[model samples]
Target: MLLHIDSSADTTADSVTRQLTEAFARTWHTAHGNSADHRHRDLSAAPVPPITPAYTTLGRRVEREGFVPPAKVPALTESAAEQREWGLTLPYITELLAADTLLLGVPMYNFAVPATLKAWIDRVTFPGALTDPDTGESLLRHTRVIAVMARGGGYGPGTPREHFDFQTPYLKAYFGSLGVPPENLHLVAAELTRVDVLPQLAGLEELAADSLARARATLTALAAA
Candidate 1:
């Protein structure tokens, strides 16, 4: 089963990562047909709320009223943000656990992953609630994640501004700690996204197109696998 998630806030044509994920979803359907089950989440439209301070301040009970049957003990009267935060986090983890693979469409925002995507990660992986305090074993460890990313500039190894990019490495650590293996966490990234829109990057248009083509080809292989 595949959980297809799109976090792009830009319009369809303007969002390169969304376009890449569309290719992935289309290729998967063509390859597997009805044999594979699919679920989708558009994070931009229904954004996941940010993790509240109470997420860590409180005891290991964020998933209580969020996932399990038991209700909030004292009923979070401290703050409305705290109460609402718990209500949304567990569902993210629940959806994440329902799939064998995750196809995420994310755009680089200020050199990092989109805020909407970061919010989802922070909430779903709350300490104590979603992870074992000691062993850190999580159901998410069994799932594979394929990230379709779009960046405005190049940040490959040894690039001039390579150190400026934090999205890829942050994702590796974020999902890695959750049990998504480094090998299983795949990235299909198209850099130089501003090439077609900004005059300063006009020369990189061909490179951007090549990256998109490569992303599609990689998705095809992943679908077949």
Candidate 2:
């Protein structure tokens, strides 16, 4: 399935990342037709488990044995124990492994990605789950990813504030560490700035459009292949 994971926390109806993601998905579906299965997850609306101590412990066990440990015996008036018991559900490792493509909608927050998106990455990046334990090879066999990003300021290469843009570099390193090739990591960025900088902003938009067109073409070829 083509899993579309939107991590933008913007509740506003006119979210740029959401709009771009929807457009990308629509184009992808139109090209692939019934050959592709669609699945969507909104991390902002339904927050997944953050990486807590209990979460880490449960995740480790699941990674080793592919099963969560059984619940312990309950004690009298142990409401806290009930909460621990609920945490024993098996992690969604299998669903992640089964995905063919992952379309991520990531927005820059304080020069980085949202914590919710990082949490999702933590869940999927198990030691032996998505990587080789002995050789340190990535188990993310699927090679396609489309990351749609947006920022409030212009930060492309050669721009004065480009050094401040850590979103692309961080995401590239993170996903590259997981075996996604540099060529497979496509980004579409939109810059929001002051009205006085509209001309420069238009240039950025043109660059983004050109990149998007190239990405769509590459994806079409990949789908055909």
Candidate 3:
């Protein structure tokens, strides 16, 4: 299954990250002769709840104390709140595990991933949830993952604000914990988005379009791969 997750609150017709991810996902379906099993999650429309103490505490017990039947949870005691939170999160976890590939649409807001995306991540990721606590094995390690990102400004290695960019590196670490290596985790990103609309950088409109095109092409190739 192909899990396509979009976290951009920008519902504008010109939302680059959303366009990129959707195009990539569609290309994947086309590549598979329209038989691809694609699933979608829109984080912006329905945001995920942040981690709570009940969930965290109970989840830790599950991780440390170990499980009974379900590998996702342990055979430990829990409060009603924790169980309720678990009830909310288990379907997402199950869907993620069932997917063979994941396509994530991430827009850099304030130099980091959007809060909606983070909330989803917090809900799905906890110690031992995507890993084996007893053996220290990564359960989701083999899944193919790709991140489609859009940035308003340049934050590349030589850019003046290079160090200000946290989205790429942080996501690499976040998904890396779940079995996606730095190599397996690919990012097809478009930069200078603000330049596309701002009069100050109107001269760079062509450059922005070029960046978007390159990102789309990269996504297509990766989806095919």
Q: Write the per-residue lDDT of candidate 1 for residues 1-225, one digit (tens) a residue.
A: 899989999856768888778778888888879667988889998888676667655435543434332143236425665556666665776677678889999898998988888878777665444454456466667788999888888888888989988888888888787677788899878888788778877777888788778877887798767
Tell me the TM-score of each prediction against the true structure.
Answer: 0.83, 0.72, 0.92
lDDT score for candidate 1 against the true structure: 0.76
Candidate rank order under lDDT: 3, 1, 2
Score each candidate by Cα lDDT. Answer: 0.76, 0.66, 0.82
Question: Who is ahead in TM-score, 2 or 3?
Answer: 3
Per-residue CA lDDT of model 3 for 1-225, tens digit only, reads: 999999999877788888888888878888886876999899988888888888888777876755322454634546788778778888788888888888899999999999999998888875566765567677677888898989988787887889988998898888876777677788778998999467766787787888888998899898777
Candidate 1 differs from the real structure by a C-alpha RMSD in angstroms, to one decimal, of: 3.8
Candidate with better TM-score, 1 vs 2: 1
Candidate 2 pairs with clashing backbones: none
lDDT of 3 at 189: 84
Q: Rate residue 166 of model 1 by lDDT.
A: 86
Tens-place lDDT digits, model 2, residues 38-64: 888898997767555655554455455
Model 2 TM-score? 0.72
Q: List runs of model 1 lying over 4 Å from the truth.
A: 59-84, 132-136
Which ranges of candidate 3 are over 4 A from the true structure? 66-74, 133-135
